[model samples]
Every structure is written in structure tokens, then in C-alpha cells.
Target: MEKQTPPEQDTIFDEAELLGDGYDKHVRRARNTIFVVASVQFVFGLVLGFSGPEESKWISIGIMSIVAGIFAGLGFWASKKPYQAILIALILFCGLILLDVIFDPASIFKGIILKIFIIVYLIMGVNNARQTLRIKQALGKE
Candidate 1:
């Protein structure tokens, strides 16, 4: 007599749910996208801190360092809580850009292309994160 394989055996994981091939690709991209956000924050902090004017050097460094730390924290959080972390990152990024434009309107045009690219990536991350969550829920995964 032939025996039947268990349902879990047919899935990618032993018990936990896994994203399908296409969804998996999107989710992987989302994870990498979040890392990009964190890395940019870190590089920006270093650059601004070191090259800022002498008078406000310490202040700039302190502020940037804190901002970088927050991004890094969110990056780590993305591994477990992708949707929430990425959403917050996107909002924070846009808010910062808005603040810059408010202080100096011309700043909006500075590296506008890069800003657009980052914003697009963050949006993609948000979409992918939502799909991942939906998949997990549909599979009845915790």
C-alpha cells in the first residue's frame, strides 16, 4: 500500500508558511530596499557630521547620528516586522524632505532624482510587505 506525504512536506517550510516563488522575489527585494534606506542614512550622517560648519559641527553630528540610529533600528525591525518598519521609514523620509524644502525651497531640486528613486523604492517595499503579510495570513501562519 502507498502512503501519503504530510501536508507540511509539500510546503517550503516544516510548519511556518513561505512566500511563493514570485512573492518570494518581491519580499526579498523589499528586505534589500529597507537596508538601502538604512545605509543611506548612515552615509549621510557621516558626511554631514564631518563636513558641517565648525560652529554647528557637534550639533549636526549629534542629530545625524541619532537619525542614522533610528533608521538602523528600523532596518533590523524589518526582518520581523517588514510592513510597519518600512511604512515608518517611508513616512520619515518624506517628512524630512518636506522639512528641507520648507527651510530652503531650492533644496527640493538638489538630488531630486535620487530622492525620487528612494521614494519609489520605499513605496515598492510597502507594497511587497503587504503582500507578504497577506500570504502569511492566508496560510494561517502566526
Candidate 2:
């Protein structure tokens, strides 16, 4: 096995080198997609907050919106600080899942809207996992 480079000695590559070869453009495109997806979730949350139950649903919607906004911000931050971006994304994801469990204990498919959110969240997890792996590989940590 190759020796791990000392964190202090190793230079952090810019986002371009993080993607390697021709993948930087693809990474940017992925970030754009993440932004779009998060924006959609944010809009959905607003709609739910305005239209659903005042006590429970609105609270859930507000949390969802906050999570979505965080996700979008992470995408933007990834351009400048990819490692921290990925870390924040992972934490946000865990928080989102926990929120979902707290808000919808009766399974995400109880409502079509909730189901859609669940699917979107699952996709977000998968996408984030791929991005994390890419970042790790680029850093020679994988």
C-alpha cells in the first residue's frame, strides 16, 4: 500500500484538479444539477408550508426549506472548497433524513408529495456518495 501523504505536506488541489483530466466540466454540471434539485425542494417546501397543516406540516416544510438551502449553498461552496463542501453535504443529508423520520413516521409514501421528496432525497444521497468518492480518489485517499 502507498503511504498516506502528510496533510500538512500535501497541497490541496483546486476544484479543476479534483475532477481530474476532462472531468472538471462534468463536476460543474453536476453542481448545477444539485443546485436545481435543491431549488425545486425549496419551492416544494414553501408550497407545503403555505398550503398544509399549520402546526405539523408547516414546521416540517420550514425545516425542509432550510435543508434545501443548505444543500444549494454546499454546491456553490464546492467550487472553492470541495472537501468541506462534501462534508457539509453529508451532514445536511443526515439531518434531512432525520427530519423526514421525525415529520413522517408513517412512511414517505403516505402522500404523493412526500413520496416525491423521499425519492429526491434518496437520489441526492446517491449523487453525494458519488461526488464524495470522486473527491477522495482525486485526493489519493481512496
Model 2 agreement with the true structure over 27-117: per-residue lDDT tens digits: 4554565576578678878887778877788786878788788888888876765556655655665566567779887644445574454
Q: Candidate 1: misplaced stretches above 4 Å?
A: 1-18
What lDDT, from 0 to 1, does candidate 2 have? 0.63
Q: What would the per-residue lDDT of candidate 1 be over residues 45-126, giving only the tens digit for each residue?
A: 7788789888887788778777777877877888888888888988988998999999999999998998898788778878
| Candidate 2 deviant stretches above 4 angstroms | 1-19, 22-26, 54-62, 108-142
Against the true structure, candidate 1 reaches a TM-score of: 0.79
Lowest lDDT 10-residue stretch of candidate 1: 8-17
TM-score of each prediction? 0.79, 0.51
Candidate with the greatest TM-score versus the true structure = 1
lDDT over C-alpha atoms for residue 73 of model 1: 83
